[model samples]
Target: MKRINTWLISTWAAIIGYFQFFPQDLNNLWQAMPDDIKASLPPYVAKGVAFALFCAMLIGRSVNTHKEKKVLEQKVEDTKDDAAA
Candidate 1:
């Protein structure tokens, strides 16, 4: 699950970076979207939704990193104890 989450976060970050660096390309893509789909979402609302999703992904990644760090620390401590004994 962590691997999958990391992959998804990396993919999303890359996509966002591409759009940021290539606004003209993004604009062209947006123009190509179906009118009904575009009309269904007010621009601000769409931005807000995207922002919320990005925040959620960031938080999930942070939590996973924290958990992995704790597990690694514990393993290191266990190894030290075994060596000492």
Candidate 2:
């Protein structure tokens, strides 16, 4: 129940809600791309790629947040050790 986990979960939930409610928005975005690009990727394939990218983004954010928290914790521990010396 870490704060970061909760935030990430809510954010992902919101994103899913948005797409569920406005699926056409995603299609609009897809259609706005160059015709050549659209031709390169069919709608289903494009959607899969977009989903994968979103998942990758979520994973990257989670890793970065945890790394930052770890570094901060390490800094605090070092400070404590230094103070005790």
Candidate 3:
């Protein structure tokens, strides 16, 4: 699970970095997309969709990290109780 999370985060970070560093290339790719596909949605709608996806990824990462932290805390508490006994 940790490996999967690391891989996903790295992949997304790379993609974002690529777009940030090479915006013209990204723009070219977007412009090269089929006219009908582009026409199906407004530009702002596409941007919104991208933003929503990024937000979902961030939220998912946060949730997973929280779960792991809680599990670790529970383990520590159990260990302490065992030692005290």
Clashes of 2: 0
- Give residue 44's lDDT in candidate 3 (0 to 100): 55
Which residue pairs does candidate 3 place in steric collision? none
How well is each residue in 1-77 modelled by candidate 1, as lDDT tens digits?
87898888888778777866886776677788789988997655544565678789999789889999999999999
Which candidate's TM-score is highest? Answer: 3
Give model 2's TM-score versus the native structure. 0.61
Residue-wise C-alpha lDDT for candidate 2, range 1-85, written one tens digit per residue: 4676668667866776687689898788888999998888788775576567668867877898889999999999999999999
- Poorly placed runs, candidate 2 (over 4 Å): 1-19, 22-32
Best by lDDT: 1
Each candidate's clash count: 0, 0, 0
TM-score, cand. 1: 0.59
The candidate with the higher TM-score, 2 or 3, is 3
